[model samples]
Target chain A: MRPLDWVVLSGTLAFIVLYGLYKGRGSNTISKYLLAGKTMPWYAMALSIMATQASAITFISTTGQGYVDGMRFVQFYFGLPIAMIVISSTSVRLFHRANVYTAYEYLEKRFDAKTRTLASIVFLMQRGLSVGVSLYAPAIVLSVILGWPDRLTTLGMGVLITIYTVTGGIKAVTWTDVQQMLIIFAGLFVAFFMIIHLLPPGISFTDAVYLAGAIGKLKAVDAKFDLANRYNLWSGLIGGTFLALSYFGCDQSQVQRYLTGKSIAQSKLSLLFTAMAKIPMQFFILFVGAMVFVFFIFVRPPLLFQPIAMRDLESSQVQPRYAPISAQFDRAFDERREAALGLVDARRAHDGGRRAQWLGQYRQAQARINQARAEGAGVVQQIHGEKEFNDTNYIFLSFVTRYLPAGVVGLVIAVIFAAAMSSSSGEVNSLATVTVIDIYRRHIRQDAPDRHYLWASRVSTAFWAAYAVFFAQYAKNLGSLVEAVNVVGSLFYGTLLGVFVLAFAFRRVTGTAAFIGMLAGESAILATALFTRITFLWFNVIGCAVVIVTGLLISWLRPVRQPVAA
Target chain B: MINSTFMPTHRAEMPDEPPPILGSWSRIYVLVLVYLALLIALSYGFTRYFS
Candidate 1:
């Protein structure tokens, strides 16, 4: 990075932090600290909700997913709008009318305290583990940018976010999320246009699109009904809906965002806004990745996007084996580039025969490229002893730091840091809220004064922040940070969603029945994860179904107690 | 009927006023669902056209 880049990066971060600290002033009481005094407008909460979900990994890895796996992944969000509508019509009013500090608190009012505690603990565990991955996402940025160790970067980011979050509370998290969301949008637009402009001269936007389509990068939907397939339309609609319902309706990190809205209408509006905008936003990000893939067709990317991995492979004993693979990769890239250009020309000239020929050649060249990449990955595995070696998370960052101009590179990096901080702050803040409100205050010191609880909240925030940093120190070995975080959430979200579904839909299900059903649901999900080839998305569905069925069965089998004569 | 006392009485609160744009909350929900269906259809078309 140049001097100007550092100036822009530091300047943007400093302005955001200062603005957050300023806006977050006067959060003295627990309610003000945790919920922004329920005074946030719909737009602010909407942006905050978006920013929370769109973590640094969303930018860094999702674009890479688009490049490597095509846009079929967009189907994963097909269920999200439906989930939002359901939550808006149900949970939004439920939580707001209850005037609860956390989603789990609603569980106590709806079910028994045991169910509430069980749900709270589930959230804390899932969110706590995922928060580390969130912190690890931006740590990858600083590690790549400055060549600092990932551990040190994670530590630094954790401390910086913890300070602001513990001091200003959700007010800081929400307001700063708004600023960060704006910056993130700006960075994305700039990077998208830059990718288009950086394309080879005479390649119009339509040509670029056609080239991406030719290479299969533009396949955004798959209509197949296979359950094992992760991103098909059926999985996206059914399994994805369950996952989204668990995430938005039951997860505290998201629940807290809308809960801060001044009124029920405002909360519903915020969610509806997300439903309307999220798919298009994802399309834009994935489209950026597809463009990057096209750009690399002309400009050869490294055999592996991760520079450190490549450097290690070069110096390892497997270097001899890797050399020929690198050569073949270069040859394949050149051939693919030629085919792509020829295909574009043939299409422009309306020659179907020539177009078919070039398309055949293009697919063949792509096969060769894939073969070379597989060989390279094999060599890297030999050197690193890590079987699931993937360089996808490095693709976007490698592009930004190498290709973008100085100021813009810094802006994109700032966008990444903003995403990381926004997401981590919300997770850490929510973790603290659940710990204090659900566990500490409810179970430990029910009669404590407001000031005492507020102090405990800040302290718990720091505790969870430190824990995330500690866990992130080891999170670097995880293959894809985005998938890793989601997988962790999926492992637990099903049972949590199941319990919530029971509370909402089945009044006859007793608390004991619901609690046991939740345990059954969790066990079933675990078994599925361990012994089946089903995709992780389906875990949510399996879990919710098991919980509801078990709860109802147990409720039916139990003997009804006779009421004493009045 | 199952015991009513065991069931918690925390019913969802109804809004005093109608939604800002839509005439009612149900309409707003329907509008959102309709938008979602349109989005899915468009995405399907985009995929088929491209692939």
Candidate 2:
């Protein structure tokens, strides 16, 4: 909001968008417009792919996760590398050899048009449903932390994305994503070092690590196998792999990124690079969150990271019930800070006995601190009359705005906006591609001129952008919106992945069998979601299993009736 | 086999090329997997050391 912050934010955004437009300048034909003329190098596609997967909200919330929970959540990506390898070997070569514009377009070649249409519709529904939430949720969170209007945030993001996407096509989106990612890296590094430097003078980085580990913040690996436990090694490796396959293999947005690669080797390389990069990237973000937690140990954080919630707690209506909780939080904060210093001193003296006593005291104070924080949440909940409340996502946002210097603040904010735009642009672009290539050109007018479809793609991109902005405004009041969006994507990915699995892995399965199996898989996943308490990650497993079994059974009962036209 | 009449038959099938660094695609894949294993091991070590 300061003059310097404004300059940095605006300048950073303007450069990324303009750079995207410049790089995408030659996208006149449909091929270049949709697939970047199949000339993109591996690195650009790799970063673009990563950007699309990790959005603005993802960045904010991940750091917040580290502050509140711990590094255990990183296990969620254990399966990603495996999924990448699978896709690199199978879908990369097949989609390249098939020379398809979208992944669903290849389904039409392997299965029937109905199957392709269904797969495309599934992607459209899942991606289209979530894109608005992805764009708006982060903007609203930023609005709360930075005191900006949410509508304006969403509008600014939508406008910047539309300008580059419509003008330069996928080329614009990819290159701009590259810039966004690079800036995001800069912002992250700056934020990380700032947190380290801001730590209490007595605490070295080693001490900080020891302190975080003592508090269980560095528990990055959980080997215990539990079905419902979200971040265990098994679920992350198994369930995570299924979700990643659904994402990178069946999802048009990701498939389209690598399809733009100059050759199969480049496309596969892009995927492999992402496989190597994604986990470390997530670790860095979460580690930043852990550092933020360490910084707040000596310097007290607010009862809740959400400022509006804090102000609401000050209101006369809530103040009577909240005062005692506020007092308790202050007491716990002092006790925790003192205990942390004592523990540090004990460790420096190599006094194991004193370290144990101080560790116990520190954890007790931390527990009390958490309790007060919960009571604050309860008061906030009373105001909203919600079932449950969490201010987890605001931890890092509040930290960045309050502590970081002015120019750096703007850069970090721009990094967020860049993430939002990069993610949204990819989804919006892919939505348009699937629309024009899979639906409009495939069904409505198969013989439309290339120029006609090119214009259609542009028009569709604008429409989705406008639609995302409009939808984001109404999405503000919906509770658990991020989880809802994630669930929506997971709901369909399994069945979608199943159909593709049948196409590639089971060549004996007929188109009718595959199509019928998809319906069965969809129904099974929906039933599982509604009737069972199974975690959403396992939804992909169940859906894929049902589809494969059903497809095989049906194919076994039937024979080929007619030859496919060639 | 499915219908291919409307498929873009005239579009040349891009030949698969070996990775620039690894001697073969299989070798590259093994390297990536090995790298993943190494990352997991390091993360586990960090957890153990700190916790």
Candidate 3:
């Protein structure tokens, strides 16, 4: 990044932080500190919800996911809008009516103190680790680009988010999210336009699409019902729906966003805004990745995107032997480029027959090119003695650093930083809320005054922020941070969602029944996650089903226990 | 007996002051239907276009 780029980056970040601190002015009480006095409007809630969910991982890794896997990943969101509507109608109203600080509070009312404590514990563990990944995801890229240690980047990002969150609380997080989201949108649009501008003279966007399609990069949907295939339509709809429901309905990070809405209507409207906008927004982001595929079709890409992988390959020990494979990869890339260009010309001429034939040839050439890259990656694996080597996480970062103009490069990097801060801050806030409201207030100091609890919230926020930063230091070489965290959530979200659904839908099921059922459901989910190769999204379905079934069974066998008094 | 206070608010009284922030079932129904239709339509279009 150049001096001008640095100026743009620094200026954008400084403005957002200062603005957030300014809005965080009136927060003194616990409710104001944790829930922003429940005064956020629909737009802020919507953008904040999206910003929290769309971490730096979404921007950096999803684009890389797009570059490597194509647009099929967009199918994962097929269930999201539907899930949003369901949650809006049910959980959204219930939580607002209860006016509880954390979602787990309702569990205590509907089930028992033990059930609520169990649920809150699950949330704390899962969200705490997830917050760490959100912190680390952007830090990885900054560390690579700036040639700094990962620890410095992680600590820098973690501290910045923690300070503002500690100062302004939820209000700061929401207001800053509005700014971060705008920068993210601007950065995306800029990247999209620049990609179109750089395409070689003879090719139109359609031609590029057709060329990408020839090699199967345009595969947006797969109708086959394969449970193991994570991104297929059925998995996306059924599994994706459960995952989204568990996330938006039950997860505090998202619950906290809508909970801050001034009224239930505003909360529902804000959710509806997200439900309507989320899929299209994700599609556009994924499409940017697809365009990146087209961009690389005209140029050469590195064999491996990870700096460590490259470093290992470039070291004196392996460079002599790796050179031939690198040369072969170059030749393969050049051949694929020529073949793709030829197919593009054929399509442009409206020669359908020749275009089809050329497309076949082009597809074969591209596959061989991919095989060579894989073979090259395998060589790096052998040299380094670490078997797992996938550079899908690196593709977009490599493209941005090498191709994007200098000033825009800095702005985009800042956008990634803002995204990391917005999301990690939300996670930290939610984690702190759960820690203080669910654990500290409920179990440790139930008689404490509002002012004491307010101070405790700040203390918990700092503690969780420190914990997340510490965890991030150890999170190296985690393939696709977004997918890894989602997978982790899938393992638990299903059962948790199930517990909540039972809390609402099955009134007769005693707290004891639901509690026992949740335990069973959670156990089943963990077992499934461990022993099976079934996609992570399916875990939500499993968790929800097991809880419902186990809860009912337990209720039928044992006399109903009375619900705990709030 | 379960505490009366923890019981859901009386259905009759709920509508009188009807909390200003309530989700409408009718609206939710319509929204769900529309999105379901769009997903199907989009899927069909993408399949046909790709085919």
Better of 2 and 3 by TM-score: 2
> For this target, which candidate reaches the highest TM-score against the unseen true structure?
2
Model 3 Cα shift for residue A146 (angstroms)? 3.6
Scored by lDDT, the top model is 2
The digit string of per-residue lDDT tens for model 1 on A378-419 reads: 877877677677778888889998899989988998898899
Report, to 2 decimal places, the DockQ of model 1: 0.45
lDDT of 3 by residue, A1-566 (tens): 78878898989988888898998888999999999998999999999999998999778878887788877888898888888888877887778777788889988876789889999999998898798898887787778766768899889888788778899999999999999999999999998888888888877887777766666666778889987888988888888889899999999999999999888778877888888887778877887888898888787777777777788777898888678878877777787788777777776687888877767776776777777777768877797676677777677777877888988888888889889998999999999999999999899989988999999999999998999899898877665555677777777798789989888787677788878888899899999988988768888888899999998887778765665657
lDDT of 1 at B47: 78
Q: What lDDT does candidate 3 reach at residue A232? A: 87
Q: What is the docking quality class of candidate 2?
A: acceptable
Error of 3 at A272 (Å): 1.0
Instruction: Name the runs in model 2 displaced over 4 angstroms.
Output: A561-566, B1-12
In the range A22-106, model 2's lDDT, one tens digit per residue, is 9989899999999999999999999999999988889998999999899988999999999999999888888888878999998
lDDT of candidates 1 onward, in order = 0.87, 0.90, 0.82
Against the native complex, each candidate's DockQ, computed on alpha carbons, is 0.45, 0.46, 0.27
RMSD of each: 2.3, 2.1, 2.8
Query: Candidate 1 — which pairs collide?
Result: none
Candidate that beats the other on lDDT, 1 or 2, i.e. the better one: 2
Kindly report, for each predicted structure in the order presented, the TM-score of its chain A compared with the true chain A. 0.96, 0.98, 0.96
When just chain B is superposed on the true chain B, each candidate scores a TM-score of 0.67, 0.73, 0.55
